[model samples]
Each structure stands twice: as C-alpha cells, then as structure tokens.
Target: MQISSNEIAWRGGKVVLVLPLPGVKQTPPDSPQLQALYAKLEGARSGGAAVAPRLPAADYHQCPRGTSVRWYCFYQNRDWNENVAGRRLQWSDPHCDEVMDFEVYSFAGQTSSWVNTGFLEVTVWDDSVHRLWTEAPNSLSAYVGSSNNDQARFFEACA
Candidate 1:
C-alpha cells in the first residue's frame, strides 16, 4: 500500500491517519472507523463529500497557543461513541470561533469498545464546543458540529 508522512500508524492491518479534515488524503470506505467518521459529518454521506483528515501541527503555524478549539462527540448508548471530523466544523459564535481541533480513527478486529477506537479530544464552548488544546484551530472549526445531540456534542478534556 502506498504511504506518506501523514500515516500515524497501520495497526492490525488498518491504517490510523491524523490529517486535516477534507484534506487531500482519502479514507477508504472499507475502513469502518474512518468511514464512520466520514459518515457522521453532514453532506459527507448524501453529498459525497470527502472525509476530513486529522490535524497536523503545521496547520496551526500562525495560530496562537491558547486560542481555544472545539470538536464533535457522539455516543450511542453502549454501542459506539464517535466524533465529527474537525475540518467539517465551522464557527459557532464569536466566543467559540476562536479555535478547534481534528483527528481520525479506523478500528478493526478485536477493537470493539468506544475508548478502544483511540480517537477523541475536547476542544471550544460547552453548549456547542470544547477546547482540548490551547492551539488555535484556524480554519478547522469553520463549519462542523451543531446543537443536535445525536449529531453533535462539544466538550474539552483540557483547557
């Protein structure tokens, strides 16, 4: 398989990439974890938009360290809990538009639990955002999560 620098890992025959959302990299549909993230974003499934890639440090060169970013979190009872790809997100409010974050996953084989998926971060406003890292999200949170519960949940692990 062709590989590039963006590859975070290729565990258990499944690739775990961490690039920008809607990035040049493509997530193979066969990869459930990655594809599921792609499916979560609106217009991705119905409009055939490309899934966003994971966040890279270079993407935030000019952004400040404590800008405050946000991301999406979605849980389904005891089944699975997934997040919205970061690039697909947009500015929620002036207070929330400060920043956001991005990352990706592709769990396979024995990895069945939510935490086992190995991808979830807090990023902006609680009602609609969470700031995991102090780095500014730049353009990552331009348009992504909404107030929709099943569709979205925003929180930050660290501020």
Candidate 2:
C-alpha cells in the first residue's frame, strides 16, 4: 500500500512508523490489503466497532547481517483490567541485523499509574528483525512462543 504521510489520520496513537518496503511494489488504494487497512482505521476513527485485519502470518527468516524486521502490539491498563488488543504490520530490510529486544511499559507511558495488569499478546511477522523492551516496575514475563516468527507471547502484569 502506498500511503503518503498526509493520508494517514492518527486517531489515538502518538507515533506511527512508516517504513519503505524494498521489494514489495506499492498497491493501489483499492487493493484488498490496503482497503482493509483503511477501513480498519476508518472504523476506529468513527468510533465504530473495528475488526482486526487479516495480516500475513509472521515467519522467522534468517536476515542478513544488519537487517531486521519487527511487529508488536502494546496494551496498558489503569484500574480494572479489561480485554484489549492491538495489532500492526511492519516491513524491514530483508538483509540486516537480527535482534529481538523485549521491553515493557505501562499504559500511555504513565509510570505512576496503577500496577500493570492484564494480558498482552506479541506476534512477530515476516523475516525482518526488531527489538522490544518494557520499563522497570512493569512486570512482563513471556508466557509462550517457540520462535520469533508467529510466536504468541502473552505477558501478564506481576501482582
């Protein structure tokens, strides 16, 4: 999908990373994937129930030195824990360093809020490499996942 900077209307997210896809050709706005992505965003913008897009399953790839790709979703809870979910896809250089870092943070970057609670699922897709990490006081423990690609890691806040 070819979404120039101006086309993206952020509703709540503070930062959205848009990276150049090396080999993947840009798809017209009407393409299925692009359409789904747009609709998903529009639903969220309009405060309607948004459905998660069917993204390509992630598979660990042997990236060349210095190239990597990473995909992740972060959830933060304040008072009572509720079921929340976030998903995204990213493209990275096929041949780069492969590093996956795990860092945890509280909801909305607020460190003094309630204790970290609820479950967060992290899924890495494609062959690119990336890093993830949480901050101190936020207890995040990986629950599952055999490999980086398509692994489901559930992190529950420490009591």
Candidate 3:
C-alpha cells in the first residue's frame, strides 16, 4: 500500500497521488469505497503521471507562521459540509521524507459511524503531501457502506 515519494506530485493547485490500481481480488470485494478508489486510480493514471510540486511557502494554509520551512501539513475536514482546515504545525527536517498512516472510511447511514475499509502506510512530502505515519489498531470490514451514496473520507496525520 505504498506509493513512493517520487510518484506523488502537484497538479491544478492540489496534490496528485498516483496510486496503483488494485486487482479485483486484492481489495475487499464488498467495499464500494475501495472500488471507487480503484476507479479513481484508473482515471488518474489514464489522465497523466505525477510531477512533484515546488517547495511550500510559509503562508500556505497548512503551514504555521515562521515554521513552514520545516513543517508537516494536511487539510482537515472536521465537518465535511463546510471548508476543510489546513494545518502544518508539526516539526521535521526540510529534506527528510516522512511516512504517514492513512485510512479510508465509508459512512454508514444505519449505524451513523465510519466503517474502516482500506488502511495504508503512505509517504508524504513537504512540497504538498504533509501527513505523517501513526500507529493504531482497527477492525477492517468488507461491507463498509450499504449504498453508493455513502460518503468516504481519508484521515491522515502530520507528524
């Protein structure tokens, strides 16, 4: 579940994650969110490859004032209805590569909870990929959502 640092890039003012499409049997057969992700990967690859972005500036939304020269960052959607909060307060060397814990979840209308679907160790870059790795235990589920209307959110961290 790793996309090497060289594969990540910035396009259209957003970070472009070039993901390898997983085979039908590789992902949980019942998780539509995973299926959607696979479709998205296919589309992105069909469109173009990734090119890393330029270095981030101190004034970027995610970077804390005076700390962006060596800071980790992410866009946090605390309440998905409104705007997402960009944060980059963690400290790290400007030239070092970081690994981050990433989780994909689907909203369950019946349970009113997020169902874990795909978990991966993703690499982040200060250029645009700011989240860093964390450790946690979770129970994975095959049927993450009951319908296609279920919303999916990716949770990542900056460390």
Candidate 4:
C-alpha cells in the first residue's frame, strides 16, 4: 500500500494490524479488548441510536525514521454529524456512550518483538462536540535496526 500522511493518520497503518469486529469474521474471536470494542459497536447499532457508525479497524504507516517505521491506528464514527447537539456535546454523551478502542503490538526482528513503542490518537466528532485523545507510545525496541523497506514490502504483500 502507498504510504501517505493522510492515510496513515486516518487508516490503521496497514491491513495486517487491523482486525475485524466480532461476528464479521470466521476465525477465533478477537482479543478481550477487541471483544469489548465489538460490544460497544453492537450497542451503537440501534435504530434510534444517537451514536454514529463505528469503524472497527483502519491502519496507516509512518516512516518517521529513515530506517525504521511506525504504524498507527485510526478509529472513527461514520454517522457522526457535523451539525448536531447545538454545537455543544460533552465528551460523554448519553445518546452516544460508546468509546472505540485500538491496540498495536510492536516487534523489532522477525520474532515476536514483544516490545511496545508506539502511540495512537483517536479523534471524534459528534457535530456538537469534537474530542481528541492521545495514547502513550508502546516502547518495543525489537524493530530498532530493521529495514523500513522490508516492513513496507511485508505490508504491501499483505495488502
């Protein structure tokens, strides 16, 4: 996949890191964390649901380092209106009480790097309220000396 700043910020860096919501896949269930996210999305599907359409997974790639690369995740609501709530919605909305969660595991070498050294930024717009949250970077040093090209190729092949 082509690596673009806009795509990286909006999509989860790549498809490999993005997992589908529950009942949408035919493999083992997602992790507990993902399961919770699926629940929130399911709850947001009501007919009168004030909540917007929730996006499960979108990945993007960032080559912040000349040699190393970083992956980011994006979660957004589809039904979110830009002009609602009189332009004053709280962070916690009674109509839309669901919060989307995302996670990424970092690796250094081909093995499970087991290192966490990346962060995620979540942006939400409810027409009345706009909110942003920045998560701390997971500090995994496994990919420290890895080649960015190799990673890019892997993502491309996976795509």
Candidate with the greatest lDDT versus the true structure: 1
Candidate 1 lDDT tens digits, 53-112: 334464332111111222322222122212322111211122233332222232211111
Task: Between candidates 1 and 2, name the one with more favorable TM-score.
Answer: 2
lDDT for predicted candidate 1 compared with the true structure: 0.27
- For model 4, the stretches where C-alpha displacement exceeds 4 angstroms are 1-67, 75-125, 139-159
Q: In terms of TM-score, how similar is model 4 to the real structure?
A: 0.20
> On residues 6-59, what C-alpha lDDT tens digit does candidate 4 reach at each position?
111122222223322344322222244433433343344343323322432431
Candidate 3: list runs displaced more than 4 Å: 1-58, 65-69, 78-91, 94-98, 102-122, 125-159
Per-residue CA lDDT of model 2 for 51-142, tens digit only, reads: 44333343211110111112232322211112221222222112123322222211222111121111222222222333223312312323
Cα-based lDDT for every prediction: 0.27, 0.26, 0.25, 0.23
Which consecutive 10 residues in model 1 have the weakest lDDT in total? 108-117
What is the Cα-based TM-score of model 3?
Answer: 0.20
Weakest lDDT window of 10 consecutive positions for candidate 3: 104-113
lDDT of 1 at 131: 28
Give the Å error, residue 90, model 4: 26
Cα lDDT of model 3 overall? 0.25
